[model samples]
Target: MVALTDEEKAMRDGRDGDAVAAAMDLLIRYADALGAEQLCETRNVAGTNTQPSPAKTKLFEEGGWSKAFSVISLDCDDDIEVPQMKVPTCQLQHGFGNDALGIMPYSERNIELQAGAESFYSSKGVNVLATCTPYQVGNLPTYGEHIAWMESSAVVYANSVLGARTNCEGGASTGSASITGRIPCWGNHLVENRYGTHLIESGLRMTGFQDWGMFGYFVGDMVQEARPVMIGDLGQPDLADLKHFGAAAASSGGVEMYHIPGRTPDAPTLEAAFGGAAPPESLHYGEAERRAIYDSLNSIGNSEDVDFVLIGCPHASLEQIGRVARALEGRTLSAGTELWVMTPRALRAVSDRNGWTATIERAGGRVLTDSCPAMSRVAPAGTKVFATDSAKQAHYLPAILGIEAWFGTTEECVEAAVTGRWRGSLAPAAVVR
Candidate 1:
């Protein structure tokens, strides 16, 4: 029932090319699955989670590039040449990093495979900027612009912070949308679906990234799928704070969008956020609730002996990298501890230019790019304990790596990285509201 333009119909009918036809067919099925009545043009920006793997390399080696493209991209049994993307598209974070800079522990074969994948995508007109925070780089989507992004944290950020429209696009859907320059018109694409269903009022004076992360964790858990308009007594948060907030919220729950009155682009006022409709219910998040959420996030018990301290779950910004460098300026990590700072290549370039990378490297830390430990799921050998400043990392690392994970402020994580011991307090001395 979805209406397609003449160009789209030609592609679907194999008039353009086999690859375009196959891609259009898949998109038609996708639109049908979504129960969408039509497809809309998307020219703002698009990103795909089309990362490389060893299995994909094997497929290419066995069946040639065309076969590999159809199998990996179109999910089809037949072979087809992959067409160039119609819109500005980039690759999201994958299991690849700059090996010369010791970004990640990749063997020679791993590096070669990663290079092959990158070359393939690059040849097909896809920018291979492999970072989750595409907005930090040159792939920013403006307010109200439609984007087909796949990463969860990036989806929340594009919607809640930048006011761009997108749902939690998956890898295949994003791939289709990128090639076709269109996605099914549903979910957050429609303005009527962007209203606030719940209201969250916070009592804490949020200051740092960790505080905002915990607040987001609490709200995401409480609100679940409901869109929330946050009305709280909070200080003005910067980009880093909102990044951590959106990352943590998307991690703990399925929150694609949120609203902060007078802060975010879409929500100039609460009434505007909800489209003049009253919120169904409101939840209060005070100091006690914050402490409780923090406790629940920490999976480690009394075993403070830490092995790794990680920072940058959504990949650190330039300002955040500077803070890390400043915190560990004169200090070195413990003999048995390691510190890994994950960030995007663009920001890493900035860090290198500003001497932050050298500062952290001199302090026994490595500034890694493209992937995090959780995504790669390969910690240093014999690592039993892990600590991080990201609530999202704290929630996922233990389950993914089966290790003791600790969550705290960036300062606390630095302290743990230096001493190989966790000495951070969970909450302040304020009474519960």
Candidate 2:
């Protein structure tokens, strides 16, 4: 059994009522299952609760929000009375909303169900910052802060890029953490496990956003859940580039943490990445490897006649929205083609003020928010083939939607959107001096 403090015991003894006790119960069980010595305190949590599903729908219909929370969130079958969250928590993206009437096949009753759940959860202090990239909006966790977060891409970004600590948590665990403010102190939460397990070196310059995604996919595939130490002829990558990279890595492999020495916060040097131990033999991500990864991501596609172009997966940064808008400013989408840019609603508002939203909309593209097509398994009606700049999306959409996917740069995707054909060709590799 995992050791619990007096305070934790008090919560379990029902000092804070049934919901918290149940949450505590779940946390203790979770900690023990992980072989964790104790539960660590956490103030940040991100999870999903509002996505409409047959199970949640039935639960809500039978016993309302409390029953749903007890069963779904707390993993308890008891109809416990839910209470306000004990710590700061936010809802992750829950899929396209009711506003997607003409565009998506999401049912009206399901939309209503989602709205009701969102209203109920918000009243209980769950911030409905409905975006996959919560860090992009607010809720940026401090380096080394223990957090309970869902979403594989966000978990990897928190650990590898922002230096925060989190495992790829699930709904029940994050829900439990939200109420009790405690999580299992195993995996990425510990300093010892944060050290690099694999070393990746690249002499080929990986500077562009596309290159970052490809390199991340390669690293993730090679490491396959192991922590990686990366040293390369990589140019200075910006926020969006790293965002794309981390998301791709998490999707291709279950990479929850990595160290880019001198770039990522945890590892300032090669030695530091390995905790003073000698680094492993470097795994090279050279031209052949990059090409192989690209082909793998694109292998699902056969038709050149593109029907949809999706621009964001971990949610687009403001600059990415602007880039799409700029590319589509004077052009209209092809007759049969549709384009969508997924971003945080907050960023979408910023994009609106910057006129990027207007530009893209005018060119027959949408600036969507609060959810992703992959999570919903919903795309434009009759979308058999899609193009995207996100390696993560390219990796997932094919499997989820049973659609062909073309992986390329944002410009190439936009061109595909405009012409309704996949004319994209990989650029000749450029070496960074």
Candidate 3:
């Protein structure tokens, strides 16, 4: 029942090419599965998850790269070369870092497979950004533009922070949308679906990124999948605060977009955010709730001789990098501990140019790019305890890396990185309730 354009119909009928036909067929099926009545053109950007699987590469060598592309990306069994992407597309972060950095180790075959995957996508006209925060680089989309982005934190950032429209699309669907330049018209694509469904009146006066993050964790739990309109005297949070908030919310729950009246672009006014209607549900977050959320995120108890401290989950911005540099300027990491700061390569270059990278490196830390501990599964091998400022990382790394995770403020994490001890307290430093 999904309607298609004439060009799309032609491609469906195999007039464009086998690859186009296969991609179109897959998209049509996906639209049908979503119960969408029609397809709409994506106006702004499209991105695919960086998929560099050694198993998939072995399949490619056994069969062919075309078959692998068809089965893996297009979700079809047909053998066809992947057609050039129709819109501006970029690749999200994968499990590997850059060839030169070599921060995370990989086998010879795995490296070759990663290179082959990059080459294949690059040849098919995809800008392999290799980082999750493509917006920080060059793939910036303006307000209200439609994009097909797959990474969870990036999707939330794009919708809530950038005001661009995108759902929590999976890798396959985003890849199909990239090739066809269209996606099923549903779920955040329409203006009616973007309005706030819940109202959150925050009573706690948040001071730093950790406070905002803890508030977001509570709100995400309260609202679940519903969009929330936050009203408070938060006093204009910066980009890093919003980044931590969005990342934590997206991880703890399924929040794709949130509205902070007078802060975010879409929510200029409270009335505008709610679409002139009052929210049916309301929640209050105060000092006690913030402390509880912070304690819940920090699962480690008693034995907290820190082994590793990770700084970025959504990849640190230049400002965040500068903060980390300033914290560790005159200090060195503990003898038994390590610090790894992950950021996008573009921002890493900026850090390098600004001497922040050298400052951290001189302090016995590394500014890594493209991959994190959870993504690459590369820790210091004997790491028993890990600490991070990211609630998202704290939630996932324990299960992924099989270690106790301690979550706290950036300064507290820096202290752990310096002294190799968990001196973080769950109580709020100063609460205005």
Top-lDDT candidate index: 2
Give a tens-digit lDDT track for model 3, residues 1-433. Answer: 7898898899789886887777788878988988888877884555554455665666688776666777777787766767777777888877654542444444555656667777877888788777778888888888998888887888888998889998888766777787778878878878899999999988777788888888888888888888988987876688778888887888888899999999899999999898999766668787778878977897554468998899988788888899899999989999999898888888989999999999999999999877677777667657889889898888888888788999987888889999999999865445444
What tens digits encode model 2's per-residue C-alpha lDDT throughout 1-433? Answer: 8888999999999999988999998888888889999889999999988887789889999999888888999999987888999899999999677657677786778778888989999999999999989999998999989999999989988898899999999989999999999999999999999999999988778759999999999989999999988897687888898888888888888899998888999998889999999998989888789889999999999999999999988899998998999899889999999999999899999999999999998999999988888887888999999999999999998989999999999999999999999988778776545
lDDT for 64 in candidate 3 is: 62
Clashing pairs in 1: none
Best by TM-score: 2
**TM-score of each candidate?**
0.95, 0.98, 0.95
Report the alpha-carbon TM-score of model 3 versus the true structure: 0.95
CA deviation > 4 Å runs, candidate 1: 44-46, 100-107, 427-433
Local distance difference test values of all predictions, in order = 0.82, 0.90, 0.81
Which one wins by lDDT: 2 or 3?
A: 2
Stretches of candidate 3 off by over 4 Å are: 98-108, 427-433
Q: Could you tell me which residue pairs clash in candidate 3?
A: none
Off by over 4 Å in 2: none
Candidate 2 residue pairs in backbone clash: none
- The lDDT of model 1 is 0.82
